[model samples]
Target: MQTLVQTFMERRGDLLTALWQHLGISMASLVIAMMLAIPLAIWAARRPKWAEGLLQLTSVLQTIPSLALLGLLIPLVGIGTVPAVIALVIYALLPIFQNTYLGISEIDASIEEAADAFGMSRMRKLFKVELPIAMPQIISGIRTALVLIIGTATLAALIGAGGLGTFIMLGIDRNNTPLLLIGAISSALLAILLSALVRWFQTAKPKRALTVFGVILVLLAGGGAYSAYANRVETVTIAGKLGSEPEILINMYKDLIEANDSHVKVTLKPNFGKTTFLFSALQHDQIDIYPEFTGSVLETLVKGTNPKGMTAKQTYALAKQRLAKQEQMTLLKPMKYNNTYALAVTKQFKQQHHLKTIGDLTRIEGVLKPGMTLEFIDRNDGMKGLKKAYHLNTTAKSMEPALRYQAINDGRVNLVDAYSTDSELRQYNLALLTDNQHFFPTYQGAPLMKADFAKRHPQIVRALNRLAGQISETDMQEMNYDVNVKKQSAATVAHRYLVQHGLLKGAK
Candidate 1:
């Protein structure tokens, strides 16, 4: 109860902000979808010859996976809300188009003849008779499209399109349950409301309501103008990686800098994922700062680590030393979390087998059901290294990386790869095997910055440094528990930690 109250107090602002964002994205998609679909449907209905081809084309788009569609758009349009909107609009077309086509085509030819006999013009007859009859079905199609787009819009977060999806994805990554709940529930509610609104439009006399809607639109246009005028400030563009943590870091930095130094405007241009890409962006001056893993920088970026053995602290120091020579790059202070990997087993299996360390598994290697990702097996410090270091070659099961735990509980696999700080470790009664051999390289979380840029923004360095030496195994476990199991928003939980630790002055 105490935790929930504290979380509510901390996350209320983010929750509200996310709500507003969701509304904006949902409505914008609906409006654009209606505009495009209605015209296309009208054209197709008037010329029945084109209906099959148009439907087939739209259905082909639907066949393409959602993620693939989003990825395909990324290079053409780059990242942010535009690509997301475009994808959602494309996805929304089928429902509205099909409904509109069917609604118009199904109208009785007798009615059309009757209207013609009354000496009405073709346009008048089409509008007064066909359109009115089709309105309900058209509205129903819009409802279906709106619901589909609303759900699909969650994927927008990956490209830095700010919506409830940002919360949900980050929450899942960090194991924050509250955030997932908030995002899921909010998305569901938006869909329900849109569905209800469509029904209401069908039942009620809509001429007056539509007039009011138009008025509201005009009012919003004016309000948007006012907001632009009021919030107008210099823009400080910072480009960097887009990931669960880095996105939040950029957002916080933007808020802090703008609040304290309003004269210096702040804008975020995110190109998320993969350390190599982030470093390249930094070198080209495309990004100002990004959160990076210290050990990853060492092993993957700066200086490759010893494949045999190296402590987390040692790996970090090695990375720091190597990066210090680079004129353009400067590694910032580390974050409170490590985001490292671990090996886990079900507690019952652990107790039954008396397994506590890698050595214990060597004896029963032939019988144990070991599970690991395909990628994990190839990486230098992954399963191969584990087996090489421990001399334990277990014949096992291969499954999807994310579903390893599910495999374990379903009695498919007895041993699986697990992250050191994963939330599910405790929730599922899993026991982490001691990595006494130090097979896995360190993956400490850190802030990497541009050398000259850091000098200009001392406060950014200060705020980040405050996070140093704060995150530990226990802290990470608890945070993961809150997110994955307790159902909290990552932004909320992250903000609370920053404030409680006095890393920042106010809750965001």
Candidate 2:
């Protein structure tokens, strides 16, 4: 409960900003839709032949998959709010246009004739008679569009269009349930409030209520414009590798900077592949920094993928020298934990075969079910490479993370790719096979920053580097246990750990 309150307080800014963006997107889409739809509806109503074709076209646009439509717009429009708004506007059109047509066309012909007989012009008739009568239905359509758009706008986060969806995605990524619930509940409340306002507008005296509403909207528009101008932050993109440990290190820096100075923003651009791909991103300046294994860097990048024999510290020092001189990158202190890959067999399988190491696995290699992620299957240093290097040609089975966990737990798979510090390995009593042949690369975590960035944010560099050589395999597993098994929030876990270790005074 305390954790929940703390998280909410911390994310209050994010919540407000998300709410504002969602409201802007929703209201803007609705207004533009009403403008185009009302006219289109009237024109289509006047021309019977065009009505069917126009409705069909609107339906077709609605039928285009939202994600696919967003993808199609990327080349032309690029990422962020514009493409998100376009997709939402297109989505809003069908219900709005259809209802506008229905509301106007459904009006009694006697009423129209009565208006005409009373010497009213066409424009006057539309305003005094048709529109007033259609007001309820038109507002209903607006209400529907608002609700649907709010829901769909959550997808905008995927394309960097900031909204409540940002929190939702982050929550899922870090398995933070409080954040997920907060995001979902907040979005729901926004929808309900907007829907209620629309319904009230439908019933209330428009001349008075709408006048007041219009004034409020104008003020909001002015305020939004002012806020946008005031908060025009020059974006400093910091991209990096997608490894779990790298993300942890980068997030630490991001939190620190964001807490102390809000102007400079650090954005993570994650590479899904290995050290080589991450280095490539660095060279291209796509990612500013990521935690990398120094040994891999020395062997892979500096030595051209053929580093023969160097101790962990030696390799790291070499990598530090190479990156500083050649690539203009700086390697910070190395963390104690080395998340090198480990092959693990279930306790049952281990006991049955008396297996403790790779040598014992040689006898039953052909019969063993070795579970690996899809990327692991194709990675050069993954399952196939490990097999060639270690001569354990176990029968490989590709499975996702969730499925692999279940497979190993259910004893369906005898061996799997277990990170050295994975909390679940101990939980399930899995026996890690020692790589006697040393097939895997050294994977000690180290933050790699751009040299210029280090110069600017020396304090951030210091804080992160203090964490180096601190987290052991046991420490990380315990942290993961607190986070995943105990279901504590990652930020809370991080803060608590930092406090306990004297890295952050009063952090908890």
Leading candidate by TM-score: 1
lDDT of 1 by residue, 1-508 (tens): 5654565567778677666666667777888989998888988887877998999988888778877887687666666667778888888889999999999989998987899899999779778898899998999899999899889988776665667886676555544466567778888998898788668767776696697568756765665587579658635555445333454456556655655655776666543434554565466554567667765676556644354466667767777777877445777666556676677899998898888887789878767888876546655566766777788766546654446776787888888887677667777888888877666677777767777877887876775565667767677677757755666544566677667766667756
User: Where is model 2 poorest over a 10-residue stretch in terms of lDDT?
Assistant: 238-247
lDDT of each: 0.71, 0.73
Which candidate wins on lDDT?
2
Which pairs in model 2 have colliding backbones? 239-287, 239-288
Model 1 vs. true fold: TM: 0.71
Candidate 1 wrong stretches, greater than 4 Å: 1-12, 112-125, 166-182, 203-206, 215-231, 234-289, 295-330, 333-339, 346-348, 354-416, 422-430, 434-438, 449-459, 462-508
TM-score of every candidate: 0.71, 0.64
